[model samples]
Target: MLVPLTREKFEQLIPLIATGPQYKYYWGKFSNFLQRLLISVVIGAIVLLFKVLFRVDFPLVFIIGIIGAFYWFWGPVFQASQRNIKCRRYKYSGFFRGRILDFWITEELIGKQETVNNKGDLVIVENREKRINLEIGDDTGFIAEFQAPLKVAYKAISSGQWAELLVMSNRGDLSTIEEISDIYIPSRDLWVSDYPILRRDFFTEVSSRLDDNEDEDDKPRRRRSEGNRRRKRDDYRY
Candidate 1:
């Protein structure tokens, strides 16, 4: 079933910003930063030791760095997947209906911080381009938040446009959307009922009943009837 999300309903359902302070990069604000620095130093020492001991250009060290960065940046999703695998889990989820409160698209130039204003429109203030984050909110508060790409943020989504975000609960990840469009959910019962009408079989039966007209040709009348039936069907749909 296609359930359209109007602007009012969208605002009502979407969540607002979480209360209190939050650690954007990692858990345990101060300790996490120290731990990260210590880990980086340890890794650097290990790289140096490897170079001294092996006496070889470790070209693959950069590859390991890349992989580590990937894991660190997306640790939640990777950890969730590992947990699901251990538990032998499977899952199903309902369509999350929400409007595009706003969206952030990355660009090469510098960008700024965006906010949901009093009019419920997403706005950005001109500034530096180092930070990256997107906040989705409703009347209650901000519901969803995701870190965006590194660069200028382009096109904060307009307020009150209907949209549905399909998600997989099993292997959750920061899978971003490229495009969105209407998705049709067909009903078996509706298809069976409309098969005859769509096939113009009703006109076939009407033509058969009119075959007894001897003085006049029934083909013209049948064609006319079929055309009328098609027009009626179109009008009913709209």
Candidate 2:
């Protein structure tokens, strides 16, 4: 069933969708190939171990050779078939729109460093109010500590390129994106829910306008502030 999602919720999902499983499907063939190769190696190792331990003279080389060939040629084909089925299921299932906002990569420890200011003072950063620390182990054990404005973190589970349209609020805190399966927006959040008022193309236009506003206002404010600070410092006596 489709559950209604706010604009903030949708925006949060986009990054996850782009860098998530749906995106991974773009190179699904290569991923499946590697999985097959790894499985083949494990099987070959087990067979060789059995032959050494049991002294079974069963045509070990022929069996292992055939297993390797099967995996190398057939694994990806099977995975591709499975992927297609899964895609269809999701298509029929409820879907949502999630748009990607800013994307950045930083060292894992930067979050810790930011906790305290340069003056060795404890600084309380408001955004970290409900921060959750996540330890994910894949490439290596790394900590992910951040506030996912809405439920955007849920969408990050998949990997690859994604595009979405999100909702924005005047305060910026309540803004979010929604993900569309294709180019068309779904009628409802959950497949069974009644359609809410649809605001197509709203986020894209809003974000552009917001960006333009910030660019225009920032330079003058920065220049005036810098000049004021310099004048104050110049008037100060040692």
Candidate 3:
């Protein structure tokens, strides 16, 4: 299902900027905080070495302090700005309803982790994790493939399960999809992605409204048989 997102619907979706998982990005995660601290320490150590070796005057304390302060305060602000820009980019987006054509999982190496062995040696171990892949399509003949971290809910997803997305198109006709939001599975009440793209509450409300309207318009009605009508007309003419 595809519906053009009008100005009214777009306004309703504006609140999404302040909702969902704000810490989905790297800059908003705790690991980024630790990385910044490590970087500041390394820079401080380099400054100390320079002062001892060349007798150069550099405010080592002030330099490291500034770096730490910038990272600590600016990271979240930058992440928010990025998200806002993204949401605005899809202001003219359309709503899409599709079905899961297929799904599977594969193992991939993410990175290497460091650990100490019983022999008192540090070793790097490869980190491998399973990622779920899904193929979704709709009546419009558009098909899309998405892959993300494996979630427990994904196990229950089978073929023909319903899914939803926010689709961006460059044309007014909304014929071609330029971008898409993370897939939302209504059956599982799960958004199948590592990061959240849509505001859960608002998205649910909008989807429910659209679904109800579609149901009302698609209700079946009885019609007289065309073959019987044509036979009666021919008999009357003869």
Candidate 4:
């Protein structure tokens, strides 16, 4: 089931901000931090060499500082900006309730590590980690696949659990899902995703409003059904 929210309301709940729990997921990763530092160092070294060997001007040296600053300080902000831009292109935000149809685990290459062999030679080895993949769908026939690292908490997830999503899509084309937040499993009170996107507090508030709307919509239909039953009873007596 899909309950639509206006774009303005959606943005109000999920504001475009550089720092949040979602940004923490990107900023807190040690591997990502190391990778960015390595790039900055390598580029800075090259630029320094240009200045020393080829007599490049001060602008080139200044560029090295800028590169380091970008990778170290402004990287997360840049990433957040890009995500916000992509999300803004979509015209609608929807509260999607669905069920987990199936799931599987697979070993994925996470990264590589350098290790010393018995012969005292350094060698690079592939690091593999387990990841869980899930297929979720609703009665409306919309199906989406989600993946997350296989952790102890996620091991409890099985088929037939309820899944909730904050889905973004264009008004003219709802069939194509532009983006989705982390999957929320209400039964287990667990969330699954490599990256967190939605603001949990705001999500809970929106969910309640949607549920109330559904209840309000059902009231008239229920009253009409009762009236029909009363009419049928009178005709039978006559």
By TM-score, rank the candidates, best first. 4, 3, 1, 2
Instruction: Quantify all predictions' global Cα lDDT against the true fold.
Output: 0.36, 0.37, 0.70, 0.74
- Which whole-number lDDT from 0 to 100 does residue 36 have in model 4? 74
Q: What does candidate 4 score on TM?
A: 0.71
lDDT of 2 at 163: 31
Error of 3 at 138 (Å): 1.5
Residue by residue across 142-185, what tens digits does model 1's lDDT show? Answer: 24444434432223234454333322234222133222212111
Model 3 regions lying over 4 Å from their true place: 11-20, 24-30, 37-70, 109-127, 220-238
Q: Which is the leading candidate under lDDT? A: 4
Give lDDT for model 4: 0.74
lDDT of candidate 4 over 116-174, digit per residue (tens): 99999999999998999989998779898888888889978989998888888886335
93, model 4: CA deviation in Å?
Answer: 3.2
lDDT by residue for model 3 (1-238), tens? 6777775565465443444354445455577788766765666576667668887766865576566545654555556557655666653667778999999999999999999999989999999999999889987698888889997877778999999887776676677777677888999887887656566677788788777765654555523376854443233210
Clash count of each predicted structure: 8, 28, 0, 0
By the TM-score metric, which is better: model 1 or model 2? 1
Cα error of candidate 4 at position 56, Å: 14
Off by over 4 Å in 4: 30-71, 113-116, 120-124, 171-173, 218-238
The C-alpha stretches of model 1 lying farther than 4 A from their native spots are: 1-27, 65-89, 95-238
Tens-place lDDT digits, model 2, residues 93-143: 222233222334333322323367788888755433232222211122211
Best by TM-score: 4
